[model samples]
Target: MALRMADTPTPVRHHRRSRRSRRAVLATLASVVTALVAALLAWPGAEPADAAPSTFAHPGVTVSRGQLDFTREKVNAGAQPWKGAHDQMMGSKYASLSRTPKPRAVVECGSYSDPNYGCTDEREDAIAAYTTALAWYITRDDRYAKKSIELMDAWSGTIKDHTNSNAPLQTGWAGSSWPRAAEIIKHTYTGTWGNSGRFATMLRNVYLPEIINGSNSNGNWELSMMEAAIGISVFIEDKGSYDKAMAKFRTRTAAYVYLASDGELPKTVPSQNLDTRAKIVKYWQGQGTFTTGLTQETCRDFTHTGYGLSAISHVAETSRIQGEDLYKTDVGERLRQGLGFQARYELGEAPPGSLCGGSVHRGLGPVTEVGYNALHSRLGHAMSNTQKLTEKNRPAGSNNLFVAWETLTHADNPS
Candidate 1:
């Protein structure tokens, strides 16, 4: 029973009109935004960020708890390669009980380790920590665990920063291993690590800042840095660093390894600003011809190339443990081709004069196991050249940087 006006009020009609106009404007704005997003996505050299996991997995940097369990089970059974690999590691100086931690206040290095101050000690200590961590798991000896903790604690307490030209790369190399040892001891060891929090702080303050920024010196540098970043992120449970590092890893992985599908000139990291053909060629170590599996440093040397490849595998393995399974993505494809290409030449296949001017370096080192195990054993990919090279270097030992005892941890490991 409301009184009806002869005509609608002027303000009410105006309000209705304004609402309709606002909705129309909103609709138009949404359409424009959608079109812009589509354009951005389709732009050339657009590197989209990969998705991050809702929750991270523990003891999952390059190696997992399941992998540890499986490897230990095999070792106990006196398995052929596993037993041999374990024996080799147990016999090494790294697994020795008398090992001492050589932490540095400020590690410094120049090009090609010219300065080499605290470089060797830092790398060796990190490797020793990881080696002992593995030994502790397989042998069930409390001494190994305590020694690992001791090594980590020494570095964590003393390492304040890394300095000089190779600081970032050096930090990256050592950073990659610290988390591996930290992850195992933090999660698996029955005894307590009193200074575990301090170790995490050292990684965050000293190591993470140096490597997480993604270097442009060389693909290997950034690759190794990202390896450290990813592993450290998992150990400290920092999701943001993990995502940032993962994005860089994906970008660097693509740019580091060349594929025929990536077009005439290899994919370039945008920040590197590799605009012209000449500049790109120089950055690629003067290799003009492009082919599948050729790395940015393939012409520079196989040793550096192996570092990039190893970092790729380590990041991919860690990502897999976190539940993303990057191996099923383009990461796996690039790794497969990269490994095979290097392996083919590494296995004594002569490169034509066109390839690296016919003089390719040998010695790929203990870098193939992690990648091989994931692609071949886990994914059932047929990689003959990689397979041969990997088998020839069974029980792959440390590269004296970050890669250590992968043959013991990952040989035919199905977990």
Candidate 2:
């Protein structure tokens, strides 16, 4: 009596059976995919999915065109710090119109630059190029743009490779500035750079190959390397390299800056294999106790610690210029705490002997401008110590490495 559709070999029954089978197969595939995705995520050092920007902003390496325009307006209006900073930069040897560029086919650097061959020259030339580009933007002077182009062309034609122990770090330092100059000159400067493609080729072949993969050395080493890689990728518009460098920046920032939430010890880089607490403490420069703002290099010294912070700020600033506000994220939080901690000590606060054996080194360098500007000016964070330290060191000039003229570019800059 219940002669259903299954009793008869009808097309409807066959269709129903087929539909049920398809649903079962689909469910099985979904389960398998979930398991595979979970496994891949658990795997160490697994590369993250690509998240490159679909359309990159021009002149978007550590500075935006709008920011440049704003700075120009401020400088033209005879503003306090902007005008002073511009004058300081213009007076520096980097902005000299008759400056020369010294490029080598090979650059060699050792620990602390023992055998420094072409190391200082490369770093200075790169900073000079960036300075001229900034000058061109602020003054609308064709001479500055041409000068930047000339410096870039000289290096591109000459430099073939970087060699030795500090090659990666050296490349990272120089690489950071070159892209800033290139991005500004190429996108904003009206003057022609006939050899711009050659410069791009040089960066792609020589510099990118050296630092794109990042360093496994000190946290500062990797931080600087990623800084260079991020800027270079934007200048070259290399999407893959951009993604890879951003990933490295994120990971290194977490491991470099400690937060109270990161358990008793600081977070470790998986590649560094800092599995045990003992290994982590040793890797953290013998600093056993972890604080919210303690850096991996705090016990090592504050100078290198400053380097790490500067790199983080530069990369975060670049990301912000490219339509992402990293200053509003955990990156911003770490930067604030790191700056505060270093600033408190640099302001001559007596430590409790728990930090850096109670004798932490000073001289935090010209690394506070960008971070202070972003966190305090834009996001409105109350940083009395950072403000005091930043104002005390106004008109920050070239560190002779990567950082240069930050006071001019980032002081109270909202954009």
Candidate 3:
């Protein structure tokens, strides 16, 4: 479903319990369990050789530190007062906007309303929760942990009664918020739920189950897969959860790939028209440009095709990590072929006006210059050891691909 943009008034009362008692319980439990689990998990015999030393510390710890320092500095810098009459009228909404709600299962949308919009998702709340929890994990700051636990409690509570199949019952409508929670839980508590068990139970019992059981249309499946993929990564430390998650992931991934290729996206876009085709073309061009412009003939003008690439990327990465031979399957081959399309298009080798009813656009300048920098950066670094590529030549966009070619030329090497 499309996100409805509106400036909704904040609700004064939420269903979550007060933070005091919740924090005391979660804090005590987290302290004891985290220490024991950390010792067990990081014991010399438990870890693989390549595990990052800090991975043993906790998930999202560094990100939390960065966010907290940034937020604290922002707050200390000063708060600006409203300058307009309308701003005064909207007083409390502006102030309470930053407060994190307690975790709950079924979020109430109608309670918050204003002239501009009806309701909004609490993405910021989830972000705050994860960041605060992570900070607590690193610094053992009771305030941060308490705040995080409060947010988690609110989220869990909201989602408990959510049964909506047409829309996400929680904020960040897609799988966004839950992943952050999972990261916080994994890192802060060393993979054990401790006081966070209620939050984990909410995710496992409510949020994730709904997403998994939902339809495959509108990239919902892919979004679900992303959540599952990240969730699997975070929880892989827990063998039982990891195994069950992997099985679910395999099923979901297969379904997502199938629906994406068999024409599910065109149905999902708001209007099935030429504009939709253009958007699809731009999206594919963006993907191709990111991959150095390798062409895939089969994917020309496939609507919302980037969703498929994203799904494939998640699956491939997960499979690689699990030491599965992804190349053995037809699905794997198709994914590789799609990646080729992305590469060829990025390199300006894809035939001009060949797709989208001869209206598809080309040139990496538009797609890669602004959109594909991070993608190129990650791929370029990952491929460096296997391929004779240098960081300077592998900048963040299509220009980097050009630099790479120039480097290869000067070195008398063909890329």
Candidate 4:
């Protein structure tokens, strides 16, 4: 994956008006009649006789095929241990974990802390493929495209054998896996790259139905529902599917949200919490680190259903996309509050020994510290009110370089 570019101050475009000219205009427009005349004068070219389709277009930048190919190679090689275990499990061809009796989902929680544990579930495999494919799409690299196709094929086949329908298992492993897969599929379709339609068909026809039907009654029902929503959203790509999935996600997410007593997430953050936060922070770390350092499993929490900052962020973003001003909603306000707590805790700005007070983990301090700064800057760019946040979290030195680069590349890009 391409890393985020270094920041180079983008030249500011300024329009200057003389103070005297402004005063003269104000004086001239003091009267009601004058003001009306001024409004008419300033009005953009009188409404067109017949409004025409907008001709506005965005500039297209060329993608780097070499970079994409290199990144795909690294992901494939690096994910080998996880892939090997997945393959071994699939080779057994057990109908379900209940039948074959694989390791419990909780066993893999340690994987979040240990790099060697490897990820379980078909979703991670699909995500690895999806990211590779995205890189290929952007770069137009045949190597990446080929590898992506291969990975997808393998994942699809493995998943098909595990579930009788499309629904996933309730195991903690599947909790992480399904969402990652769904996100990958969603991005692939939106990006207009690869066999997104065919991929969706496979998921809907084979993977999802089984997982959903099987796990529907379990406590993991919400997890399955959440992933299903994401997958259905990608597959249907219509208002109906979008509405249905959105409704379902909202309904199921209530449980987790309710777990937040008085709208505050518990402070005894689990290992999963750290892992999820680490990846969420890494997302803004820039493209290079994102492509090389973060994996699909690592980033799953950002898009999944759970009681974490990542989940809250996803809900906020999803609501915004749906044209709902989440900032005005109770959940949105709660998320803001939670993020405020995180910021205070991470920065050592909170009261000593307070619930929201804790030292940043040594392993994650560097990346998250930089991430906090970048995230605040991006947020500040969108809302002037967040300027203080940007300043408060601003990273120093080399870390600042990534934030600058991201600003140049994505300054005008909206979430």
lDDT of 3 by residue, 1-415 (tens): 1333333334445324434445666677777777877774443213222322223223321123333343334333432211121122123221233465644444444322221121244444555554455345444556656666666677665655443333332321334434544555555453334555666666566545554433434342434344453443343334444344344444333333322333423212222232454554443343222122222222343323443444444444334334443334533544444444544544444445444333444332211211121123322322322122222223221121101111111111111
Candidate 1, residues 194-259, lDDT tens digits: the string is 999999999999999999998999899999999999899898888889888987888788899988
Candidate 2 lDDT tens digits, 1-415 = 1211333234565898777766776787777788888775544323355646788998999999888988999999999899999999999999999998888999999988889899999999999999999999999999999999989999999999999999999999999999999999999987688998999999989999999888778899999999999898888899999988888888889889999977777876787788899998888888888999999998888899999999999999998888777888778999999999999998899877888788888888999999999999989999999999999999898789999999999999988
Q: How high is the CA lDDT of each candidate model?
A: 0.89, 0.89, 0.38, 0.33
Local error of candidate 3 at residue 362 (angstroms): 11
Off by over 4 Å in 4: 1-123, 161-198, 206-228, 238-244, 251-307, 322-328, 348-412
**Tens digit of per-residue lDDT, candidate 4, span 158-263:** 4433322222332223332333333433433334335545655655655454434222232224434444443344333434444444444443333223223422
The per-prediction CA RMSD against the true structure, in angstroms, equals 6.3, 6.2, 21.0, 20.0
Clashing pairs in 2: none
Worst 10 residues of 2 by lDDT: 1-10
Segments in model 3 whose C-alpha atoms lie over 4 Å from true places: 1-98, 102-105, 108-122, 133-146, 163-165, 168-176, 186-194, 218-226, 229-308, 311-351, 359-415
- Candidate 1 weakest lDDT stretch, 10 residues: 1-10
Which sections of candidate 2 miss by over 4 Å? 1-48
